[model samples]
Target: MAISKKNKSKVSVDGKEYLWWVFDEYDQTEFDGIQIKAVSSDQTHFIKYGLQQSLNNSKLVLALKNYTKLVHLSLPPKFENNEGVITKTGINRMIKWCKKDVHHIEYALDGSRNDLTEAEKQLLLKELQKIIR
Candidate 1:
């Protein structure tokens, strides 16, 4: 499905502009969470993130906290904008994650079958800290 242009917002990351939009899959039973989609202004790079619902908490507090860590690494929580539009930091993080071939984080708090390994997570975290600053 094509995302309407009116629904997309603009953000620039690393001097490159990107168009981003949030796809709320309310009827989706598998993940039961929103999907953030973005593409570079030049249409060269595309990235998507599935922010799945946490199995441990229905309120999404724990899920979001963990997701923030997984998605943004050590970056502050302010980088995430939950109110429909995505923050610039969030876009940058998504691009970084995409380049690493990392996508969504499962809701398993036990770290079972996650997308990123412990070492990989640490590496990405360090890289994010260095670049995002």
Candidate 2:
């Protein structure tokens, strides 16, 4: 993994504190050392979004489980666009590429495009704020 620019800081917002860092992968090496924690699940979602944006590789597509290990891959445009006959068989293939023991995270194994819930949007906003700052 190549870190093009590194920014590490502590951000406090609305009486909450967070750790923020940015990375850039100039090389193809795997990026696996990112660590973040939050006081609540909502904050976790925000931190994740901020971290992901800093490591901007348009081809970067990660399927995470339980907020721990992430299965990173260079998914084709087909997958990103949610096209193709995403069947049980196809999902099985995708699952094969998953990290075992990562549990209880939201996954569209069937390759469906489901809208984020209100709670998810709020968490995403928190994440966006971290990046904008």
Candidate 3:
């Protein structure tokens, strides 16, 4: 079996819904939250394994620090009186974060493309295609 079984079906704990996820290799993934999966099965597996490994060797403090950094990076510039704009520093930081977070193979496969202004997106798409191809 693929091991997509539920141990405690539809149970609520402390007003939060939790699901018990099992892997065919006898691994268990339990959570009270939802996460978006990658479109490709290989990507999904790679991401899940990476997360599980990180959860094992990493401290909560480090996780929290990473979360805080992500939050800071995600915050709108308007919060700092920049009016919801991303400065060059912000873009550089974002690119740095991506370089650190993403695997080289995946990065090569899918370049830095996102829903930005048409001109920017086009430029990113062009560069991405060049790298990917």
CA shift of 124, model 3, Å: 18
Candidate 2 lDDT by residue in tens digits, 7-107: 54444444444444433443443433332222221343222221232323412223222333222233322211144233333322322322222222242
Relative to the unseen true structure, what is the C-alpha lDDT of residue 95 in candidate 3, on a scale of 0 to 100?
28
lDDT leaderboard ranking:
1, 2, 3
> Which residue pairs in candidate 1 have backbone atoms (N, alpha carbon, C) closer than 3 angstroms, thus clashing?
none
Clashing pairs in 2: none
Q: How many steric overlaps does candidate 2 have?
A: 0
Best by TM-score: 1
Return the number of clashes found in candidate 3: 1
> Which of candidates 1 and 2 reaches a greater TM-score?
1
TM-score quality measure for candidate 2? 0.24
lDDT at position 23, candidate 3:
30
